[model samples]
Target: MGDRQDAETFNNLLAAFGMARGKLQLPCVPALKARYVQKVIALANLLEKPLTSAQVEELETAIAQELAKGFQASQHSQLLISFQPNPKSVEQLDFKITCQIASLAEFYEAALKDNFATDSDQLDRLETSVFGKHANARVLDLLPELGDPETTTILDIGAGSGRNALPLARSGYAVDAIELADTFCQQLQQQAKTENLPLSIIQGNILDPLLRPKLNHYALAILSELLVHFRDADQARLALAKACDAVSKSGLVLFNIFLCRPDYQPTIADRQVAQVAQSFFLTPAELESVMDGLPLELVDRHSVFDYERDRLPSSAWPPSPWFINWATGRLLFDLEPPPISLQWLLCRRI
Candidate 1:
């Protein structure tokens, strides 16, 4: 009980759990995962001494990061992981890592099985909750971006559960919702059908050209809260080109994304955790290079939180519980403020 444990001790626990550094992506349910915690506790008991609160907290973060990595490995496409710090239950061993997977697994698995039906669920300790109630405050400002909603067409890429697309449709905009998840697509579809809104649900990756039947058909393309999941600048470049290609000449492409501030270089650990949390970012220069040859021209940039928060009434408030923190880059890393922050970009098609 005298020795304070560290990452070395934690590494030993991971070995005992059969989740070695390279093989942490094993899938299991919460009860089973809870059992893994007990097993690791037993191993820690047999070998290492009781850990200090600081040590336990450090281990908890490591576990959260590792779990996020495993989760990122589990996804078919890029998945935003919400790595929370709170232990699922801290009573048993005073350590937290293995138990953290329970929340993420249950949530993502249910959504994957089309069972996520409530308004929203916390994606992680950071409150990276998905399936929020309100449309983005910024997305609601479409009227000024392009005139006459009835005459203009907008594409909402990665349109999760009609958050933005549905509102746009309700406001009488002819909107095409491009969504990847079947559950989100179904939700948007049913909602649109029920309301008889001018929203069409197109299911698939936004990178696919086939998804867009006609070239330059949309007056605006919005990739809200999407670009962060992209791996690097290459993916961003391609996705931007596609978004630009989908819009008419001089049309607009509106995307909100995290870009690294000057002189802030993310380490390998930071990058991995970001990918796990779906908070991937490119440097502003990298972004500029990516946009160099593309038809899209950056016309405007705004601080996401400041721009949206200032515009919304106090009653509208956050737009969603997760919107404020997530927009400001508070939830991307584990308790550490990321060097990157979100920006609202409005680009015109050249």
Candidate 2:
């Protein structure tokens, strides 16, 4: 059959199947319903041999029963159901899925780049896009609490694009950022120069001994989205200890890491399967244990829900449904609040 005929035939089958399965909730229009039933019957007749009315009814009943049973079986599994009232938008759904696949493809491509943009404008945009305004405000909010001194010196570890560094510098804090990516270091320097912000960028591993001596020079330090990259617990702990030592006794060492929960069976994303393998998720308790012997004290801890608004300023999209289920439903962490998945912590060196 032609494509048009095939589409009509499919719609008819869908309507009839929906009705028999008690899934159809459209308007009670006799004409529309009749047309739908006719299409379904036509398809059924094509699939099987010519059937009497009784045979058609019997087949419909059998199909409905099977569908209900399938749904019931699915309920026992950890499957999430999203209701879409209109099923006529298969093209739209296909387009959306295709776009997502394309975007992921691009992300992998960009991940392969030897250098990424970390310019001031780029950094600001990245921060605002990824974390939103509230997170930016939170960073600023925590800054003053670090206390004013002769000069505000900050060590931003994992300083991806200097998101926190630029803001801190704009606020008059002298910022020094350590990033492994040379491209990011160049971008950061350009951004600092453009804004005339006294920010310094060092291209070297934080684990390097050559960089070790310079660690104790900062008054404050931050490790936003950094700890998750470390594979060894002892290394992370040692890094935190070094951060504590870098800052003055009264200075603050602020950072955030991805906390793992019991239900967190490692996934492709967790393993960086899509991109270069780098990040490791850790349990909050495991992190606390890592910091046990360190001089840093956990002054505050909370969870940040990532919510994003569309460009049109419509409704907000909560963290991906999969993330919500993984973080909250799986009970991965001993989330102090009892249910949150992502943990944000602030610490001060004693």
Each candidate's clash count = 2, 3
The digit string of per-residue lDDT tens for model 1 on 1-350 reads: 33657555666555344321111233322212334444444454553334455654565455546555555444222212222222332322333244223332344446544532343332221111354556766667756868888898888888876767877889888998887766567667777888899999888876665665347899888898888767678878877888888899999889988888788877765665565565778788888898898888888899888887788777667766666676677786544555878898988999
* TM-score of each model, in listed order: 0.68, 0.53
Model 2, CA-based lDDT = 0.53
The deviation in Å at residue 276 for candidate 1 is 0.9
Show where candidate 2 strays beyond 4 Å: 1-109, 112-135, 213-216, 262-279, 306-340
User: Candidate 2 lDDT, tens digit per residue, 190-228?
Assistant: 789999997888777777667762546777788865765
Which segments of candidate 1 are over 4 A away from where they belong? 1-43, 46-131, 333-337
**lDDT by candidate, in order shown:** 0.65, 0.53
Tally clashes: model 1.
2
TM-score for predicted model 2 compared with the true structure: 0.53
